[model samples]
Target: MAGPSSFAARRKVKGVQLTIMVVGQSGTGRTTFVNTLCEQPLIQHQQPVAPEEAHLESGIRINPVQVELEEDGVRVSLTVVDTPGFGDQIDNEFTFNEIMGYLERQYDDILAEESRIKRNPRFRDNRVHALLYFITPTGHALRELDIELMRRLAPRVNVIPVIGKADSLTPSELHDFKRRVMEDIEYYSIPIYNFPYDAEEDDEDTIQENSELRALMPFAIVGSEEEVEVNGQPVRARRYPWGIVEVDNPQHSDFQRLRTALLQTHLHDVKEITHDFLYETFRSEKLSRSLVGDSMGAGYGAGQDASVNPEDLATQSVRIKEEQLKREEDKLRELELRTQRELAERRQELLAKEELLRSLEARLADAQHSNSSTPLPPSQPQSPIPQQGQPHPVLTPHGGAPTNGLQ
Candidate 1:
């Protein structure tokens, strides 16, 4: 029952690290929620756009802000990753890729670093423990964009759907909207991080607590950075003409519950699931691909997932490097083999041509020798010799009637 403000006296503890990413379209109270949850202005409000530039597409920006908060007297170092201009663009497909790419890149970084021989002691794990996806308060059902994003990103991160600016809806409207959103999530089979509890293994209190929190799927949140006097007591609230909305008031908003869960009671759970389940799945897939000699594409941007243990990351890094080196070695060996074969083939061709020329030259030389040694064309015809009193007829140069040259 301890809220963020009441955590100072609850329990004292050592340091703990928690990182949460807030993703939602602008104007969904994302900035205000962080400030209200931290009891200070942790994030700067985005500057208002001029009418002239309102229609332009501004790309998504992932900004992580670190803040120190004492939850239940335990010093909690929190990192809030804010996705600004996420859904603000007319073509928001890019933003979706940006976010998903960011998640995958963190995993990929660990994938690469895990295979390194030497571990980088200064390496920091920025993998998101939880992704709080704020559902726009349309006072109706879930938007297609909402369903699509949750469906796609759930596989990569722990997506906890929440309704932002719940003050926009009436009690009845909000009830119906939450129901519809959950229904849509279920229908689409989006694997949101519902508070899961194993009834048999978990204690009774744990089972009850998890069940209760699970029912609050898509927690409604109202956030305000302004403080106002409530019954002579200072309280963080939003000043409205109708009434004031207190940020920490359970009757007013679930902001306090979410803040506590994120930084206090369920903090370790989220991180555990991130490292144990989500990252494991990604690791298995990448290893399988690398096993088959396929590149992991360019998903490993300059980011690291918190899910990877430092030692494991270092080991994996070395393995991956060795694999890459082996592949390169294989390529070089093949190239050398090809060059050698080509050189041998060229030499063979030259030898064959030379042999052919030598054969032709020998034939020519034989012909010349034969011609030089050949009997010259007879200058005069050989006179026929009489054989035993037979008159021999000689071929006459001017063909005198060949009467044996006696006529």
Candidate 2:
């Protein structure tokens, strides 16, 4: 049995590419995990987010990073995408609505772009290669919202369910977690993995932990029967060189494994795609040849002859560009006018505040001066009597010796 790092060294493959996505509720360490994989601190939010701040890119935004990993003559291309935690304790509804809206807009945008490409002669067929979904483990089973989201996205993409934060669970607890997760995902037929199962630890510890998981999750499966244990309640998990592993963070260990696996698996598994699929695949070199030589002969040449005219395409493109430029100009003019009006209003507000402050200060000063100038009435002097005291009385200004108590 090999450790996670050693498995990385042993795995041999070439030129594999994969796109991975990390998702969860707000503040579930998604960003931190991505930064670890990228080997750099990416982005983090300091406060609870509203819908407006969801797209702000400072905190609640999607971050994409790419890296290449080579081990034992095997090369893999990994693209890790970090998305904002959809629902937060403080702003659950707002975040959910915003994210849902964004995804809807995103799908629409993709479809629109695909339509544009299909309409053009130059690009007829292109699409994204693979899609990986990441989620942190929770005590409860997959939520209704999770299932809904997965159902919506599964057909359109190759959904890989990654059980992130496996380190948080103990051996037995982890077993239960993986068991429940697989059972829930059975209906969707989504491939699931208990990833990041403490990759930094020794092989013995990880294998032991994995075995416990296998025992509890008997019906759950991996890529192959040989790679996983379905019987004997194997309390010690067998090592798979290609299975996902835990690293210090998602971007480094599990992230690397995902990248390496995709680069290998996609190159091997993907063969032919339909015209509809091509519109999304982005027309990479590996897939370009697969588009031609169809039975119906509905290809680049046929589409070009039937629906496209080169001069018209060029004219339409130029017209679109001109319209885009005009829109940009209009937006800039509107922004400038708004800015000037805001500045004028701010200046007036500031002047009013200053005048109010000055008036208050003057009133305060006047009150203080009047208080200081006003004099208090003098008190009456007391007479010193020799009979009442031991000392003799002193004389006063107006016969005070006789009148002031000389008796």
Candidate 3:
């Protein structure tokens, strides 16, 4: 038993999983950042397109790559999903739906699995825990595309906004850029993951840590696969004409802090939020829509068509749910009234039985009293005459008339 228990514990420890998706335009240094974060060439850089073929639209593609990593002595099965050719098209409106569809598809898989009578032994959960949206280093504010993508996707995933290639701007410019981006997000009411913590419910260290991380929203990122010798030690740094920028240095970039938070400090928190909140919310909306569709007959079944507007579907779903709830409440109230009526009828029957019992007892008491109060009659003498055509009366030896009957 001890051997098997220990083996199972080890197996569980070895299977810690985390999925992250990177989304941004092509030149935002997403590939470099991922490689730098993983300390390997996990993703191959795309080839440069020819000038003649540059006009072609490739659309959006979602590619998931899995790798094994060890962080803090725990084996992590990490899946990095890359969104290439996003926001690169002329319109880019359909790209949002593509990304959203992919995210919801994973949720749909889990929902289907949950509804199954028999569970699949080899089920794999590919739901993304965090999304790192790389912002191009513009030294200004968020673009319309950035705002739109984040705003649309924030409700479905944990969006951690980061500026790719932070070394392109001055320190002051980078600070102001971060401020403006956060302001735009606030103005738009985008629900990005902001390192949430509760002061009253959390410990002092947690509150402080989360507060600091929140202040550093839209982390500045610098990525390099090259290593350079600095101060008699080799470190990952990007060489430049004037000075070298170190990837791990706090003064240079927020890469190290972001890495630590993603892999070590808050990995479990990210996964928990994804499963407990985001996924559950989606699951509920989906099930509500399905239920509403089924209850409203074939018209709602046809409403599931993609040609129908999404806002209309949402409105119909809410209305149906409200009607269903109202019907259930009415049924419950009727049941309660019926139960009260039955209880009242039972009470009346019991009261009638009690009254009848009381009447019977009174009658019985009266009969007993009459019998006890009455006295016996005096003894009567029998005549010594016989009936006509009858035998004469016989006497006992003592000359007494027969006591059996009158003579």
Put down candidate 2 lDDT per residue, 1-407, tens digits, no spaces. 78998897666654555445655655445555555544455545446669876765343555556777553465656566556645444444454454444444444554566436245454322223343444456755777656655565554444555555554445566567666777788876654432224556648765674554344332221111122233443221224465433342232224444534345433333312212343233222112322332322655454443344546545544555576689779979999999999999999999999999999999999999999999999998986445855656555666654343555
Report the C-alpha lDDT of model 1 over 175-268, residue by residue, as the tens digit.
Answer: 8988999888899899999988888898999888788788777898998777799999998888989999888888777887787778877899
lDDT of 3 at 322: 82
TM-score of each: 0.69, 0.39, 0.72
lDDT of 3 by residue, 251-313 (tens): 899999999999988999999999999997897677666756676665776456565567776
What lDDT does candidate 3 reach at residue 122?
90
Compared with the true structure, the alpha-carbon lDDT of candidate 3 equals 0.90
Task: Kindly report which residue stretches of model 3 are placed more than 4 angstroms away from their true locations once superposed.
Answer: 1-12, 301-407
Which is superior by TM-score, 1 or 3?
3
Q: Please give the lDDT score for candidate 1.
A: 0.84
- Best candidate per lDDT, number? 3
Least well predicted 10-residue stretch by lDDT in candidate 1: 288-297
Backbone Cα, N, C clashes tallied per candidate: 10, 15, 0
Quantify all predictions' global Cα lDDT against the true fold: 0.84, 0.50, 0.90
